[model samples]
Target: MADGMLGYGTTVRIGRGATPTWTPLALLGDIEMPDEQADEVDVTHMQSPGRRKQFIAGLLDSGELSIPMNYIPGSASDTLCKAIKTSGEQVLVEITLPVPSGETAVPEVFSGFLKGYARTAPINDKMAATATFRLSEAVEP
Candidate 1:
């Protein structure tokens, strides 16, 4: 991963016959983020399709996803923190994937995976905003 990406880890818990199962997963490595001034963070970079899918898969595989957003400690607030303090803030990201035929149900899988991941994942000061899925496209395979 690039220095611009953030590092994260996750744990998932599943319920079985009135019992819950727990699983954990961590980022393969640290991710890089776009350089910005102190207190000016950009959460948009974290919304890539590959990242999203990997997150979802992590959740499905372990029943939990943990994303560690990169942070710079300083006197100023970053774009990410600014957006977090303000409600109704939105960012756009584009993702491309090799279109899968048949009944892959990417969206459904993504939703379920996120829900499961979010249920157990923790958000801290390092996190600027929540992860959201935007678009998916099939590339020539």
Candidate 2:
């Protein structure tokens, strides 16, 4: 048995505004959480003895979250993704992780706009789709 929680029961929900009515996305395959990054700011000056680069952290970015799914045309997930992209509106995405045997599920929430929704079809493989959410604010882990 593995010590970590399994990804099988994880689920993602999305909706509009600061407070929203979350709609569960369906047929999702796997979800990749956002990778946060911070910008490095250089603070080197002429008075520095060894000319070592002095640095500081600038703005923090709650990188993009990508969701891959089995593409189902006209499904709620498909329709919502398209609508969100077309509207260019900020939405709240809540990703709930699977709970361990004795622990509770925690949802990571963030606000972002749907960057892209791409669909693919192959003759020898199952149809698939992916949605990229570009985070605009700090993620609540």
Candidate 3:
């Protein structure tokens, strides 16, 4: 296998409107990239010969992205996340993958709706939250 880039410098940004003005979120942890999947259709037939199951591809799912970050109430990131969830509006997400030296960066841009935002406060640990976004369309270059 070839050498792959590390996840040290990965960044996630969120924005709104037709011509979105991107702003990076002060993420505190790893970012889960979109996991694109396709649905399968099973077609079974009973013939004179042995029975077999046929399958075909159905609709494609762009998949969801889960991001973990520090929870700072009333902050811009927190407010934006809540607004998106409350309004049920689609927002733009830009994920820039880190590349090696002198290599062009790869960005995965897509439109998605904020699915969920949950915060946790532990006595021994810091306050953290997870934001989940459901992709509504194909990810662009």
Best by lDDT: 2
Among these predictions, the greatest TM-score belongs to 2
Q: In model 1, where do residues sit more than 4 Å from their true spots? A: 1-67, 74-77, 95-141
* RMSD (Å) of each candidate, 1 decimal: 21.2, 1.7, 2.2
Q: What is the lDDT of residue 88 in candidate 1?
A: 33
Error of 2 at 27 (Å): 1.6
TM-score per candidate, chains pooled: 0.20, 0.92, 0.89
Residue 21 of model 3, lDDT score:
72
lDDT of 2 by residue, 16-79 (tens): 7666888988888878788889999988999866978888999999989999989989999999
Q: Candidate 1, TM-score vs. the true structure? A: 0.20
lDDT of 3: 0.84
Error of 3 at 70 (Å): 1.4
lDDT for each candidate structure: 0.25, 0.88, 0.84
Query: Worst lDDT window (10 residues) for model 2?
Result: 1-10
The residue-by-residue lDDT of candidate 3 on 37-129, one tens digit each, is: 889988766762366677788988998988899998888789888888999988888888888888999788888999999988899998998
On a 0 to 100 scale, what is the lDDT of residue 22 in model 1?
20
Clashing residue pairs, backbone N/CA/C < 3 A, model 3: none
Structural RMSD, model 3: 2.2
Count residue pairs with overlapping backbones in model 1: 18
